[model samples]
Target: MSGAATSPASAPALVLASTSPRRRELLARIGLVPARLAAPDIDETPLKGERPRDYVARLAEGKARAVSRASDEVVLAGDTTVAAGRRILEKPVDEADLRDMLALLSGRRHRVWSGICVIGRDDRVRVRIVDTIVAFKVLSAEEIDAYVACGEGMGKAGGYAIQGRAETFVRFLSGSHSNVVGLPLFETRALLTSVGVPLG
Candidate 1:
């Protein structure tokens, strides 16, 4: 269907293949509202020896393809992770895990990587990986304890939320802030537009 013509009335609807409120809110900021929200059911376990970028890319594309899409629908999915060098820090399993993650991140720089995938109406898959480098000030045991007790980082990657109270810990950030939150808007909009998905 190369060079196929399409009409405005037949434009495909965008389907967001995630239920994360942060992602939904981020899309809204770009004036793109998904016609549907699907919670992608996929194993999120990292493959042994998989790099962070590859892991996120695989997960994002997996999610986008897992969702059932109609001929007139385009699916979008994303995966975000916090990486300290080659090590990937996932969501905290418990308070101790959260504390350890915070401690490991204290007074150091880490990278937040997000992989975004789009399954266009043509069934062509497009993926973009965006990374942001962030640095945290040295954290004391008291600060860790207080943050852990507050439970803000419970299910967050790297056991922290840059858009939340954890922002206080950030001494430097060198990339897309929204990527740290969940999705990278600049790349996302680009992917959507490239796929003929209309955006406001």
Candidate 2:
């Protein structure tokens, strides 16, 4: 597509159904300017025995539907989870879990799952799930202590942030780098195009 400006009448209208700064910046990276930003309120509790892929996908769709009350706009929502084997690692709420998470992720491969929901103007919803594999280098006790001391691990999945200090700990990443950062550009851009969103 050309770098031409779409007419306001022809421009795609989307309501981003999330409040994550990382997700917002990612949309800006691909030149999508959402007509609205709606932070959805939904229970994030994982169902008993629910796997990471199913968990993220359900939440993504729920968030989109929960926040899409206003009519005439397309709604987009996403949910991401970090998994170490079958155990899904969520944002740590306590220091003990945080410590365990960091240690377990060290020198091991983990998967990050991101689920995306695109609700079209016609109320037709299309979804996609992206998985990224990452391996963390062996970390020293002192390094983990310093990282946890700074309180940066509190809200991040897998007890680390690839865009921050934890970048040094990543030895290999085998999938969509953007998905691990909270959004998947390739799948996201494709969804937007299907719903008539202009992209360059």
Candidate 3:
């Protein structure tokens, strides 16, 4: 019975440890569909004075380990955040918060940090942090007001979506575009491949 249930060459199932639609879409771009989507329930509160890099890295690994996985399953998790210097700008709590975030980012360079973690079939963990620099053109009061009214930036990190209307505001960008979106495809693909996950 045991012999019939096991195959030597069968690839382990991929489990995505997030429920974000954008993450699902990003994974599909690489032709990999997760066999299961497990949204890990972990406290994401930043430690007092935690830097953006440390904050994302800890969350990614925590999420990956929080999910239950079988021996034949590989878990993948990622966390992304926007930071202005040492300030970590998380999801906007309200319209007022969104407006403030946009105003703060009006005409300066900020960083988007994405931390990716993969736990392989052997339970070996791999993590990588990717950073992207983005600059926004100076936004006028009218522009900020209109953007706030549109409500596109609500609930998004840094109060803006680079793939949406916010793209127009970008004056400069350096590094992985996908990192700013949510996951860094290059780093993610490499980690997945290293952990024996098949990729198209």
> Each model's TM-score, in the order given?
0.95, 0.92, 0.95
Tens digit per residue, CA lDDT, model 1, 54-135: 9999999999999999999999999999999989999999999999899999999999999999999889999999999999
lDDT of each: 0.95, 0.88, 0.94
Model 2: residues with Cα > 4 Å off, grouped in runs: 1-9
**Over the stretch 120-173, how does candidate 3's per-residue lDDT look in tens digits?**
988788889999999999999899899889888987899999988999999999
Error of 1 at 116 (Å): 0.3
- For model 3 the TM-score comes to 0.95
Clashing pairs in 1: none
Q: Top model by lDDT, which number?
A: 1
lDDT of 2 at 102: 93
Query: On a 0 to 1 TM-score scale, where does candidate 2 land against the true structure?
Result: 0.92
